[model samples]
Target: MNHKLLPLKVFLLLALLSLSQMFCGINIQTENPTADPGFMATGIAATLTARAVSITPTVTTEQATQTATQQPTETESQQPVQTEPVIPEAASISVSLDTNCREGPSGDYQKLGYLLPGQTAALIGRNSTSTWWYIENPKKPGQYCWVWGEYATLHGDISAVPLTTPPPPPIPIAG
Candidate 1:
């Protein structure tokens, strides 16, 4: 007789006794068929509740994955680079402050005109000094004058051509 056989035999007997005790506590006095029906209904409801809880998270994850796969590809590819547009050739620019349009190139010059806010002018030329601009006054049409470059915005849509008529043909200096 092996000693291991003795322990195995004891374990088997203890398992059978525990199972019998469980059965004794479970529905053994079922002379009442009404009691059996209630026990069966409770077992069925508990099984359904356990199954529903186990399946809910799996169902939600699968639905989310399907939606992600179905999204349009074009939306991912169409992102544009954001940038400001370049100023057009005849684009308008603003004056920095209130100032006078002068009659000549220097500061002691006579004031030929004045410009108010939103006054649009034709940009003719930038002086060699670069501080003055020759502009055409639209209010007093056909009048051309020198404006401090600091005082006016070049109007968009006005040509860059010389504001005044082209100069007369060069005089034929005697040889």
Candidate 2:
């Protein structure tokens, strides 16, 4: 046998032995036959040898049952209930005239919906300059839009109204 091929053969043998031991749950014993310095001096190639050895796993039946029947502690069993941050209804705005609710702070934005005369909406936010009030649209449930402050009367602290970045307009889907 070529001396160059001896190491590769030894490596493959050791790897196969380890994999078999892991998957079959069998214990293995390995010996390097040419480990002695004099063996190589005598021109003998290095060889790997292995044999099966018995090793019983240490897991006990009582330990296994205890692990399977483990109960959660009181802290683990009870979780803190989560609640949404209450944004106080800071203000409500009533439209003085039929006004357009736009997607953004400016009139240049596309109209999302409308605020009718005498219609009131909850104030959500305002622009940096406080010229716009972002409000929840009464016409569209669960939807918010913006109306010009000039055309509406604010019923609460306009300063307490949080400023918000307006959402982008919905992309028009082309049919």
Candidate 3:
């Protein structure tokens, strides 16, 4: 018998014995060969168990795999890569903080949306003083809203952004 198979055979025998040990145990005794071996009564003896198993030896530290490095062979490479400079898109407002985007150019206007931090909105129009930009509503598509310039940073040209007149407030202002 192979030495490697010896452990497997012992493991199988122990497994079968452990199953029988669940119900009863076996006692080996010497007697007449023909005599009837009477009922060998047994009981579940213990709660905890111990068994020997075969496993690879543990090392104190991780072992690194060794590999042979190959020397690079000479080969011809490709042409110089062509690149284009990225230009910032014109007429946009990026809000530094979460600010209310309203129906028109003032605080009196009903808030239609929010210009959140890291959100950029297209600038199509501005107030006469450029203090408010009439922008595409960040929350509603194709609808327009106005955001205060105080919390917004303008990108590209505002010169060509058309001057927008403020619309009448949706609610009557309290005097």
Best by lDDT: 3
Worst 10 residues of 2 by lDDT: 45-54
Instruction: Tell me the number of clashing residue pairs for each predicted model.
Output: 0, 0, 0
Task: Note the residue pairs that clash in candidate 1.
Answer: none
lDDT per residue as tens, model 1, 1-175: 9774575456556645885776565542323223355556666766777677566665445445532122222222224445555444463434534556655544556666765543556576656555666666544667755666655545454455433432233445688
Tell me model 1's lDDT, rounded to 2 decimals: 0.53
Cα deviation at 82, candidate 2, in Å, is 27
Of 2 and 3, the candidate ahead on lDDT is 3
Model 3: per-residue lDDT, tens digit, 12-87?
5664587568436444343433422231111111111111111334354577645333333333443445445544
lDDT of 2 by residue, 36-134 (tens): 455443333212111111242346665554322223222222344555564533587866467898878886787878887546688889988888888
Please list the residue runs of candidate 2 whose C-alpha ends up more than 4 Å from where it truly belongs after superposition. Answer: 1-89, 168-175
- The models' CA-based lDDT, in order, is 0.53, 0.67, 0.70
Error of 2 at 15 (Å): 87
TM-score for all models, in order of appearance: 0.34, 0.44, 0.47
